[model samples]
Target chain A: MTSTIVTAAILAIGDELLSGRTKDKNIGHLADVLLLSGIDLKEVRIVADEQDAIVEALNALRKRYTYVFTSGGIGPTHDDITADAVSAAFGLTCEHDAEAMRLLAEMYKRREMEFTEARQRMARMPKGARHIANPVSTAPGFIVDNVYVMAGVPQVFQAMVDNILPELQKGSHLLTRSLPCPYGEGDIGTLLGAIQKAHPETSIGSYPKYDGQRFSTELVVRARDEAKLDAAANAISDMIRGLDAARAGSNPGPEA
Target chain B: MTSTIVTAAILAIGDELLSGRTKDKNIGHLADVLLLSGIDLKEVRIVADEQDAIVEALNALRKRYTYVFTSGGIGPTHDDITADAVSAAFGLTCEHDAEAMRLLAEMYKRREMEFTEARQRMARMPKGARHIANPVSTAPGFIVDNVYVMAGVPQVFQAMVDNILPELQKGSHLLTRSLPCPYGEGDIGTLLGAIQKAHPETSIGSYPKYDGQRFSTELVVRARDEAKLDAAANAISDMIRGLDAARAGSNPGPEA
Candidate 1:
């Protein structure tokens, strides 16, 4: 057994996000990236910039999952308290990082922007943390134990993740194959149940779609084992083809 | 002064969500609803279907936030373990409800779908739970204590929330005002600092937007008090207009 059990979780922190002022696109994008990298995304939580809430979520998620990624609330605003809450969760003190401050100072100097106390607020880091570089923004993200903290902005968060993903351990990639079936979910439920029983290791999903005129369904088969996945796909494809043939022989009804 | 403080948190469950197979959208929608209803969405967490992860998140978030909403893993599949996990969180047993079974049986009969053992799985509810009717889907959502368990599908989740939102208590709504300035964030940094100091109760945010022809910034002012929010907005707007007039006379250049 390859022990294909790599789990991860995401904690999104921000009042704006929870208030729906900013729609979070990072969760889905990160999920796809982590899945393709052979890591099972297990859970995601969105919390406001409250200290107690952040601390509770952090402690719970970090202990259960192999990796925990948090986004937002790392800005210079008064409500940007994710760093402090993260520190509290781990029982560590947040301090200004010399390297992060240097980076911020250098960037501000280059742009002729004032490095005010508010701007310097971005340089604070939880004690005993490693920095996750942000290419798009001067403010650097940090990693404490299994938790990876990044900015909430989609562009900045993605850039930081790109810099960090290559270094993490990945399990066997999950393989999926899907075939469109011109049948209703009711008609294919029995077949799907049988298929699921036949391939215990593989997971089968049925998605129904109605595009104006036709009622179509997509049967998806997924597995971590490449060979088993392919075999399951072939079996499903054959079953669908047989169903289509049988439907043709009968008096085909009007398009549903 | 009426002191109204409303808080909510979201708990997203399932291994598929963390593995990035499904992009969770219910959190954002719920966040919007809660905010509009004057409830501060305090926190959200995505955890696996594992008993420990779900139980820990529930206990922590429930104790900290006023209300907690959960989505996903409430289905007929073996991986659908939210009901069991929620029951464990409350130190209760998972039991089949006669009312829930009645609802499920009626739904199945209406759809002409078989009431199989798998379908019966939908009737399992956490001990001492109230039902949340799902207008879009047959499977009804449930509430235990302060935690509301909803479906994972976006459309269905929205419908379920719509049915439940009006019943929940709402606090006084927060007000927001914005003033657009034709200056960069760097230009208005000092002025924003002074504005923050002047109105300690408000949250002022500067967002930079780059159109093809020009660069401009928008200063958003937010507060729970309408009078304070209006006062801050007017002051910020006046300051930005002054800067605009001064710059036009001094530079006499095209907007960029």
Candidate 2:
């Protein structure tokens, strides 16, 4: 059975994220979740709340990727302008979505709170949009076309993602194996390239680290095929062992 | 005297970042540091360790911003294709620089380590590029045109930034004032929008938070002029206070 290749892009819109006032916890969290679902998150853009920037990035990402997920700029604040941007990107008029308005109004009434005009702004979305139910704050995020507008708040973002993920079509699972090698990238860079070339089905990456005292590398192998991934990983492990043995056998003096 | 405005963009490169194997710490850290230096960080792009992807992103960002800072994919590993991408972006030939080769050889010699061919790959850079010395590791990062290609390791990245920042031309500082409100964005979003319009010189943003028990908001005012920033901040403070008073004054029943 062949699996569908689903791809996604993230548009993290906020002035605070750009200004570094708020460190983005959403990008990493979503990246992890999307990968587990076999959806490849190809790229991510962090832009300010400017309508033009948001619209420009949104349109560019939406047309290319299977899905474009946006976080932040969906709050009740003046800076929360994702809805307007989404509408402008698709040339649709933004208005108060009827179902969203009704749901929010009922929520406010249940809490003994006034559904003020500002609160109504939370219900504003592009025409023909559907709501992504917000069980936390009651103001729902909206889905216009393939763009899933989500709240920037970490808790709300996670909840909305949890609510919406299962509805999407599935892709083949992406499996990975991590092997820690007691060697630097320099020790295995050449061989790793050869291994990657040999196992065309698997993707291999080498990451080097220096910890004050010594250097080490983490080699990660990824593939859709379980056998290919395992074989590549085993090859990498053997390569590291061979290199260690060779180094131990040779004791050449430093050529100053 | 008017201040010169400098803009910057960050291109964080790596597959591990996209796969969620490594959570990005460099983007936030660099954004924070760049803002304090009077540089307006406009956009950030996180892309996988692919050549065409890196080249496209680098070219796009380098042309638009005053400076484009790139992190990751600069290691000696086979997957570290950033240097090649950098070369391709500007059509420069990638080769081992004499200075970088000398530096790495000396460093390895001093440590009684072999400067193997694989280790020499660290010296590969675009022709005519200058080295950004790595204090933590012996391998050097390079600068080509306005793009600063730095190491992915957080410690090395920070050290390179610290070393490079002071030499660049300075711009007028961006100042900010933050005011906390004991209300949600819905309570003050409209009024905050009005305040933003009134203070055209300052950028005002309202961020709402839900702590599971209560709601609160943080209003931030930013401007190059300290006086303008504080003025906008005071206006927001007064508006929040007025909103609080109005809430306490009215005892409206829930309209079911």
Candidate 3:
């Protein structure tokens, strides 16, 4: 269990995110990636760009999870303070890194944009931090200790994460299967209860959706073992199909 | 400042949340509530329902933030182990609560449904925990020390929080105002930079939006001080309006 265990936490920093103006879709994306990789997503946090708040969150989450990924607050704007806050969390002073500056300088030269003082702020890094390569934007993300500080924008963050994921340690992947049922949870609740009782290793979830005219349910089966997951899903699917077939046979079709 | 400061971190639990299948909107909603009441949202975390994962996250977040609000995993399903994990975090025992049982019994009676063992499982609460009244659902959320455990469903979780918020301590409220400009961020970036320099107490954010054919910008002013927020917004608004007026005068009307 110890060898298979891996945990991760996400810290999203920005005022735009807190205001509900910018709906954070990245949390879900990262969570899925970590889950598939068998890294348990232990926690996620959203904080304002205030240094104190970000620092406090970083310190706490880093100590708990194996890895902490932070998004937002790493941009060129004055409000971008994730790097500074991360540095503060580790009790390190922030400085403009020569390597980071070189990367930004090259990016600016290629784009033909002035590398002004404001833009230069993007090159600042916490002491002893290594840059996470950002292909889309010139200003690379940095990794300090176990924390992976990446961009807020989805595309850039995804690219940065994709670049870094292969290098990190991974655990056995989580497995899952879903069976769609035309009936509501009420109709299949008893069968689900029996299925759950029999398969303690598998987790079964019932999700109900209403499409205005009709109601449908999606029963999902999940487990760490691929064979167990498939077996459990097949059993549940067979049970649901059996019930449907029995009802159809007894009723002998509405047209008849 | 210490006396006036109130902090909160949201812990979202369950595999469904980490997956893109379900977008966790509770973080944004809770952030707005916390901000409006002057309680700073320090962080938000999404974790799977594994015991150690949940325990580590709860323990870490509860210690760092003044208040920790957790959503999801407190249901009848097998994956719903937030209460158990939280209890483990505090080194407490989980037990069936008389108050919660009574509430569940009443709810079941009102709905004319049998209060089965599975439904009764929802009544289990960590020792010495106080119940957070839920008007929408009978499964009352619990508060143990600094941690508030709420439902995963958006409406139910919000209802539980609404009942709990009034009872909790609040900090100084954050105030914000938005001023829109017809030009893009690049056009008014210089003026916005000056506004930040002049009002160091306030944070100015510039957001650019492209509506297919044209580009527009919204400059937002935010601060803990209401007067400072309003003043900064007014100054930014004046500068933007002046730019628009200058453009109007220089270009003249289409007819002219």
Per residue, candidate 1 scores C-alpha lDDT tens digits across B119-203 of 6777788877999897665678899988898877677678889988988889888888877778755466667778878999888
The candidate scoring highest on TM-score is: 2
Q: Per-residue alpha-carbon lDDT of model 2 for A116-188, expressed as tens digits?
A: 8888899999999988988888788988889999999888999999999988766688888999999888777
Worst 10 residues of 3 chain A by lDDT: A207-216
Quote each prediction's TM-score: 0.82, 0.95, 0.77
Candidate 1 has an lDDT of: 0.78
Best-first order by TM-score? 2, 1, 3
Give lDDT tens digits, candidate 1, residues A50-121. Answer: 798789878978998789999987766555688899899999999999999999999889987678776777
What is the TM-score (0 to 1) of candidate 1? 0.82
True C-alpha contacts between chains kept, each model in order: 0.38, 0.77, 0.28
DockQ of predicted model 1: 0.36
- Tell me the deviation in Å of residue B141 in model 1: 2.2
Q: After aligning candidate 2 to the native by TM-score, how far in Å is the CA of A112 from where it should be?
A: 3.2
Better of 1 and 3 by TM-score: 1
Tens digits of per-residue lDDT for model 2, B1-256: 5979998999999988888888888998888888788899999999998898899889888998899999998887778889899999999999999998999999989989788777888899999998898888878999998999999989889999998997766668888888888988877878888889899999988877889876788888989888888888888878876776677677754641
Kindly provide the TM-score of model 2 when superposed on the true structure, using C-alpha atoms: 0.95
